[model samples]
Target: MPEHASGASSKLIVESVSKWFRTPRATVHALDSISMQVAAGEVVCLVGPSGCGKSTLLDIIAGLTKPDSGHVLADGHLVTGPGRQRLVVFQEPSLFPWLDVFGNVMFGLKLCPELTNDGRREIAHRFLGLVGLEKFERVHVHELSGGMKQRVALARALAADPQVLLMDEPFGALDAMTREHLYDDVQRIWRDAGKTIVFVTHNMREAVCLGDRVLLMSQAPGKIIQAFDIPLPRPRSIYDVELVGYAARIADALRGTVGGGVPE
Candidate 1:
């Protein structure tokens, strides 16, 4: 585990963030004046259409990409670049093929010369177990299924004891069955670990399942069209979504976002 400054803010804040991409032919407006805040320990999911800049916004929050205008903050401090304090878990496993599960998970720790070998091992093992991959620690990344690979990536991120986890559709590539299983696993690990997570996805159910609040984005110039505080309490599973009105509210929110900001 890494050092945690006592009494420091862990909140994530974004203010008037706008990002425009310059392609070979034309400039595209990705995000416009996007502002949002997620308190420490809050799970907020960002959902939008294909070109609505959902992932771009996530990149800004993670400091993987810089915004042309506005600011991104973590713990009330501006986020400029990637740091161990904020780990980004991608849709697929981005492990080094040359390294086995253990080596891959321990890669970041290896660079942090401050931690001892024993310290790194303990952290890696704890997170692997947290994601139900303790038995697979010695396995190669190539041998793992798509779901398992993503789990490893997630475990790698979790092993760092991140204050804020930035996940970009971490299950988007998995089959429905596997995605649901991983969804349950993710929910368990996130709650048990008490992490502040910002998950991005187009799947409405996934958003509702993972987020304490769901923020829906509009077209190219993404902005929050609607945000709903999930009334259902955790330990909330996919099965619990049978509530009559909950589905409609979520569906409406999803449609409203992708339907180009029009109220249905």
Candidate 2:
């Protein structure tokens, strides 16, 4: 663990968390005594080889999955289950086919029942615009391109006004060009929204580009092996020379942990 792993100013805390999976064949240990903290409005990226429990950790923090041991806290409160304050944007858009883009975003606001219908609708449109999809509000999910669908998913997640945003490789399925464009969009949105983000990715460069801190995980049962503070200037480019240097260093560390080649 590093100095930044946990601190008094932390917004999200994972204390000695662990998890396991039991099946007919065998019981697999997926996580081991994981503990870390995410500061408010900070962006942290988790990177590791496949099957390293990266997604599992994200789910635990999101309260989508319960830890077998220990616990997680958000804003000094225990995370018993999913709450409106924590939202996830998964790899796939997972939008409803029956709903248009605006309808999809509006649906996420269902979590915020305190708001009136008109207020929720306004928020949906505002988030759609933030993600540069206001014009496509009426477009059906099936008609949108892969990147467009992901943008809609982001808008939906943001519309809920979650205090913490958990993203599990939201851009993994897009083409290279689309991903590059999205890298910029995500940075802008994150800055403007000032939301705490826990992003999980297999791409080292992507992590370096977006993270204020990059936490490397070991193979299952996953543990936070190293934390690299990226003090680089904001609105980073994936292809920047300095950014590439950081990515390469993290990639070397990743390979050492996995005992093989690093994921893209």
Candidate 3:
């Protein structure tokens, strides 16, 4: 947690968090006393080595798994379980093959039927266009490219209208070019929409380029070892990336925690 605490952080707070899992063979301590915070509208990226329990930490926050101890508070309210205020986007699109793009995006609306059909469609279309999927509204999941599907997932998350978004390697499976494209898209939408996002990835540059504050975690029983505030300006282009030291600066910190390097 560097000194960027000027309060632009979106009101996401995790206090003294820890989690463990029971197994037939033995018990495993997945996370140990992890704590951090995301100021409003800030992109806080978490990066660590393999098996560092990064995903497990995410699960705990998303309320899919409860921590053995500790608490999570969103916007000054305690989080007991998954709420409509928090939306998640996983590495996969998590869309139903049976549902078309529009239906998939509107799936969460089932829980909020109070919203009229037209109202739901209006919000869905706005987010879809943000992800460059305005034309694929009627297309089914199988008809989309990897990037397009990711966009749909993003659109769905946006449609849910959550104050905070949880993203787990949303572009980890895509090619470099596609991933970079989505990276730019996410930055644009995140800034304009004024939502708090917590993203997890093994890609250091992806973390550096998108995060306002990047948190580096250690191995199992994970903890934050470094936090860097990216001082670069917005809209850092592909060709201009070399001029920005964000990638290199964060790479050094990540390599320390990774105990080597995950080559690009």
Candidate 4:
């Protein structure tokens, strides 16, 4: 368990959040009375089948989307809208094509208007280094591979110095080898930065590899069905026999929730 997993302090509190999407043709209840808390500096992964409202819940926590009947509190204050204290890394790298790797990271620091130009530049370089992209600072977005692009996205989010990092399947698109490498990188960065993270993913092993607690959600009208505490010591490998065992158990639970098979 992480030092903060005891819930000594809740960095983010989701109180009975529910969401709905209504169209002329139909009404969809995406989330139903969903609630969870992430401790400061702890990593929690939300895992569920497709369209389980995992991303919707994350957006509400980031204040990017409004909830129908609940609220989110960050650092004891209600989250009314997106704040500098919280930042999101989406599935795509979403890097600016016109900007080099360093410039892309610098763009995220724009949220911190208090920092001097030099201060922002320093932070940008530091985060790029942290993501192992210092050598490619001048590289353009088009010139990099898929994994490198995601690394830049990770650097950009970290450069902002958000108290909570919300990632919505940020590595879902990469190839297996690249994802394995990124898994290692992300674990190292999370350990060193100690940033509160709420990650959304469908991969069972990925959740186990990165999360301190894996929250499994049911099908549509998503509700957290089970929470599994990963006590395996870091830095964990996707191939570790113990890690595979835990993932298998979670996969079984997930299949039951979805009423079908689940991807590893």
Candidate 5:
């Protein structure tokens, strides 16, 4: 568990952030004057069309990639490089093939080297249980299903005790039925663990179901064009009538961005 839970400041500030990708033919502006603040322990989802720099922005926030201008601040300190404080959970599980479930999770705790082996084991077990995978701790990665592989990944990230969790379409590849199950699990884990989360996805309903606020990014020169606050109760159903309405609005907004047309 994190040292601070509720009321602990895990705020993230993106100040005038911008990025560009240079190619032989052209220099593409990936992000433009992006700025936003994510409150401590709040779940914020980034939703946009295919070309929008959603993943690029996430990499910047994680310090995995450097921005051409501006900076990201976690709890008032600038983020220069990847650190344990801000961990990224990618679309792929990226687990070691030879490592079993328990070993894969323990690998995340390598960020906390000061802890004894037993301490790390305890943290690993606790988080695996949190993700409802305690019984399969010793199972090999190949033996697990796609959903279960992601569960281990989630546990590994949580066990690292990162103040901010950055997820890039973590469930985008899953089947619809599996994704619904994860929606419930993720919300429960976020509520109980109390960590600031920035989730990036193309799925509007996924954003509506999981995020407290959904940020819509425009195409190519990605900019935050709209932000919708989801005031619905937690453990939101993807099938909820009201939630469907919210998703529709966001989807329309995304379409407008993609087509370069005015929003309906």
Candidate 6:
């Protein structure tokens, strides 16, 4: 990891942000005055139950959804709308089936109109190589496996050179074996790229493996109840005994939140 990866500089800030959704039948309070800071190049994972608004908070940070009150800041500037500097990778690959891998990655360059056609192509190739898809550049999306499709999506997002990557369960749909493989790949990418990452997942072991800090959230009208600092060494493994101990501790905290008890 680079110096930036472990440095203590704040990158993204959420200040007392709250959100609500009003329906014909009832109003759903999604978030309740949530606030936190992410260090530049740090990997932070948000873990909670289904209705705890983990994804909702991710969207708000991506500028896809605005909060009902308060606001978010990126590098001291207020985040009003989506920008290339902040990009999101959702659970679904959402790739364009009509385009080949190279073209699909180049499509993301649309957000960066400043680049020339040649520059975009070069960048596409670079990121594809970074994600170990250099040989699959001409493959169509439909021909790729589930994990391969996600690698392409990841390549596309990284091609844009986003400073902050918001991942909402990017590997949730993959098979156990595939997901385990991706866990290593993602950590390598994060370490080499040195970008701040905010990952949301329901998997406690995944969070413990990937995050420098794991934040536990309360049930709906979600608020962060606990932040667990993972003191284990880098390049963690899901099966590591020390890592499993941390996951068990986090799981207990999660259970408390879900059971209407206060989080430790």
Instruction: Give all candidates' CA lDDT scores.
Output: 0.80, 0.92, 0.81, 0.92, 0.90, 0.89
lDDT of 6 by residue, 59-115 (tens): 999999999998988888899999999999999999999999999999999999999
Model 2 alpha-carbon drift over 4 Å, by segment = 1-6
**Ordering by TM-score:** 2, 4, 6, 5, 3, 1
Off by over 4 Å in 5: 1-10, 260-264
**Cα lDDT of model 5 by residue, 1-264, tens digit:** 111223344488887899999999999999998988888978999988887999999999999999999999898899999999999999999999899999999998999999999999999999999999999999999999999999999999999999999999999899999999999999999989998999999888999999889999988799989889889998799989999999989888888657653221
RMSD of 5: 4.3
TM-score of 4: 0.97
lDDT of 3 at 15: 80
What digit string (tens of lDDT, one per residue) describes model 2 on residues 71-157?
999999999999989999999999999999999999888889899999998899899999999999999999999999999999999
What TM-score fits each model?
0.90, 0.97, 0.93, 0.97, 0.94, 0.94
Extract clashing residue pairs from model 6. Answer: none
* lDDT against true structure, model 4: 0.92
Put down candidate 3 lDDT per residue, 1-264, tens digits, no spaces. 562344344387788888888889988887888878888888888888877888988887788888889998788788889887888899988889999998998886665678999998888888888888888889999999999999988888888888889999899899999988998998898878988888999877788778888888888878877788876678756345652466676667767666566643
CA shift of 235, model 6, Å: 1.0
What CA root-mean-square deviation does each model show from the true structure?
Answer: 4.8, 1.2, 2.0, 1.9, 4.3, 3.6
TM-score of 3: 0.93
- Which scores greater on lDDT, model 2 or model 3? 2
Candidate 3 clashing pairs, residues 3+ apart or interchain: 9-39, 9-40, 10-39, 10-40
- Give lDDT for model 2: 0.92
lDDT of 4 by residue, 1-264 (tens): 321243448998888999999999999999999878889888999999999999999999999999999998899999999998999999998899999999999999999999999999999999999999999999999999999999999999998999999999999998999999999998999989999999999999999999999998999899988899998999999999999999999999988766778987
lDDT measured at residue 244 in model 4 versus the true structure, 0 to 100:
98
Error of 3 at 54 (Å): 1.3
